[model samples]
Target: MQLTPTLLAEATRRGLLSTEQGQALWDFLAEQEREQQHDTPSFKAAHILYYLGGLIAIGAMTLFMTIGWEQFGGTGLLLISLVYGTAALLLTEYLFERKHLALPAGLTAVLAVVMVPLAVYGAQHAIGLWSDGDARHTAYRDFHYYIDWRWLVMEFATLAAGAVALWRYRLPFLVLPVAVTLWYMSMDLTPLLLGGDNLGFFSDLGKLISLWFGVAMTLLAFWVDLRSRHTKDFAFWLYIFGVLTFWGALSSMDSGSEWGKLAYCAINLLMIAIGAALSRRVFAVFGGLGIAGYLGHLSYTVFKDSLMFPLALTAIGLAVVAIGIYWQRHEAAIGRSLRRILPAPMRELVEQRRG
Candidate 1:
């Protein structure tokens, strides 16, 4: 299916295409390839470096922040965060407009979005929003490691700033920070929704809320996936975080009965079917993990003493492998058939490229 220069030359020699027509076709195809390379993420060394550098910079300001940063105090921290955010924005504009570097520009924009929470935290600290003895008052690092209702203000600010950055840049990478902040919000909102800090995150109410939130986030990602038409995928990060949130919460919940566990396996199988229909590997990955966990449970508990257990498992494994090979061989036909079962409007959505 790949068109090459040799193929074009052969066509020209065979009189299938005139020399001028072949040259024009080659030029158009080459330009399209160039654009695709520029806009899409790949494992190319330069692209890897771009993401690596950006992630390190973002982690430095957020995940890897130190307690030493607290020495600056409220007003000083606020000023420093403002300065850093402004500089990142200026760099984003320069890279995007003057240098024509989309990847680097998007990274800088993400950096700016990441700074919003820090800035919000600083502003809150300056205004004495944190009481003197509170743990959250002492370090910004708790934003990631701990769950508290107090972090809601910063999370909301980050979401708003991320929206602005996405609007300004129209870059797919801008969705990364936004998706992450939404995940954080899902956790933090639990304490507030349950009406007290007395119940920690592991409480039953918190888990149920997280499960519901994950469903909402996944539906949002689906809507975005259907609408996106850009060269780069904008819903990829959203789908990843959404599925992780949902699956993690669902898996962590206690399923006491045999029937309940069987239902879990069935749900995971449905997830696999959905993944095939949507062409999203994220669903397939989590669904496969869920199914594997169920199998492991059966191995250790239900069939542990049975003599035929090992043989049965081996047969199932081989069957799965054979099915995978068959699936790969007829993947295009299977995908087409799956698409046909969807509604007309949703069929179009299914045809869109997935991350």
Candidate 2:
């Protein structure tokens, strides 16, 4: 995708363009890169270290938290969280708004928003309010391991903080924490919505809810992608969370009928096709896993006693490899034909992604 000097030279040598035209194209691309370098951030050591240090701090205080952190008492924890969040916000203002350091600034903003859960948890503890029953003495680390409807408090607070940060800073990376909180919220809400029943955590009812919510989130991500084409990419994390949630739910189904299992395989194949058309490889990755799961079922169940199964599977694998090679050689032509079949609006979206 990068236009390099050697690539220009090769194009000229192949008579694809004259030397002057090739040079002009290279210079134009280089100029665009230079103008965008600040927003995009370079892959240099200093930038890498900057982001790494920020992420370590963020992760230590959030995901890597231990029960000992709660020993400071609720008020102390609340004060500490507030102090850390304020410092991050100030740094974000300086680095992102004033210095135009988009990547690091966005990470700092994320860190600030991620502190909201700690603050909320501390406040709840201070107020003597426990979301779950008889969990007044529950360890803080258990919040992550156990899914309780009570954790909805922290999830909602985190989501709110993330949304405010994004609205104020217009940073695409801030969407990650928001999306994560939303996913957690979906899981935690399962008990509340379908409670008083025997359906446990990650049961079929919860999976169905997660699947439908994931579908909604995926559609929302597509909408954001369309709108943010000229700005920083905001839909990437949404798409990631959506795909993970949807695929996790789909893969966990325990259907007993052969037609149902085959239907699952068909849906996974459809996902792969859609992913290819949209150029989003996440769908392909999940779809491939689903297909593999189905194949595994066949090997372990339907074809368990048959010697021909292994040979047939090997032949299928070889055929797939051949198809991949052929597609790699003719990708450009295939892309053109695919575009022709797409509706006008979808064609425009695909062209934008190509750019």
Candidate 3:
């Protein structure tokens, strides 16, 4: 099926075409392949630089923002963010609509999305909606480091702006800000929902809320995945952050009894199975860590005095490795069988990815 130069030469040898024609066809196909690679996302030098530069810019604006910028005050930060966002959006329009560059356009759109929170923070402060007296609410930089109920306004604004940008640009990378904001909202909403002057931010109730929010986000990702599979991997970021939120909150909760810990292990095992079934590695990675942590706990406690523990652990590790080898060898058949066992709609979901 692959039209390679070797195959073309063989055809010419068999008198199917002249040497000139074979060379012409090969050159044409090579050019076509190159064009396709250029059009799509890849690990090429240009593409790598595009993303790397964009990430650094984004980090500088958000995560790496300095305390000195706090001197700008709310209104100043607001105006600066709007100006930067406008420039980024104008550039995005030029790149996508004029220059026809998708990667850089997406990156610029993401930059615009990142400005939403800063603008919102400024508006809140300038209008006296957010009090400057609160330390957590004093500066925009704390937005990345602290979780306060007051951040809800900025978080909601970011989500809205992110949604609008994604809808306008139709870029997969635009999902990043939305997913991250949702994750922050999950934590920030805790104190607000539980009710207090920020009393239950790290309470047991907050943890449960996080777990539930993660479940919702994961389900949303699944829905997005099923819909976007034919177009782009728009659901990828959502699945990543969703799993992170869920797994982190789940792992943080105390399981006082051995039975409780065993139940936790079982839940993680289910996550791994679900991940494998869906071909999404995010679930598998977190699940694997959880299982490893449980096993480590047992080794340190239940098997501490047993000399055979090390041998048992080694055997288990080797068995897992063997299973992986066997799975890789029979991947096609196994994948087909797994898909077959699912309900019709679920099978369709997996089949779309596999196909």
Which numbered prediction scores highest in TM-score against the true structure? 1
Q: How much lDDT does each candidate structure score?
A: 0.87, 0.84, 0.87
Q: Which prediction has more favorable TM-score, 1 or 3?
A: 1
What C-alpha lDDT, on a 0 to 100 scale, does residue 206 get in candidate 1? 79
lDDT of 3 by residue, 1-355 (tens): 6677788889999999999989988889888778667656789999999989999999999999988987787799899999999999999999999998888899999999899898988888788776757555567788898878888888889889998998898988899999999999888887777776465436788888888889999999999988876777899899999898888888999988999999999999999988977889999999999999999899999888999999988998899899999999999899888778887767877877655
How close is every model to the real structure, measured as TM-score?
Answer: 0.92, 0.85, 0.87
Candidate 1 per-residue C-alpha lDDT over 170-262 given as tens digits, one digit per residue, 9 for 90 to 100: 898999999999999988888788888765557888778778878898899888877784345788889899999888889988998988889
Q: What is the alpha-carbon lDDT for the whole of candidate 1? A: 0.87
- Candidate 3: worst 10 consecutive residues by lDDT? 194-203
Candidate 2: where are CA atoms >4 Å away? 1-28, 35-51, 131-133, 136-138, 197-200, 325-330, 341-343
The best-first sequence of candidates by TM-score reads 1, 3, 2
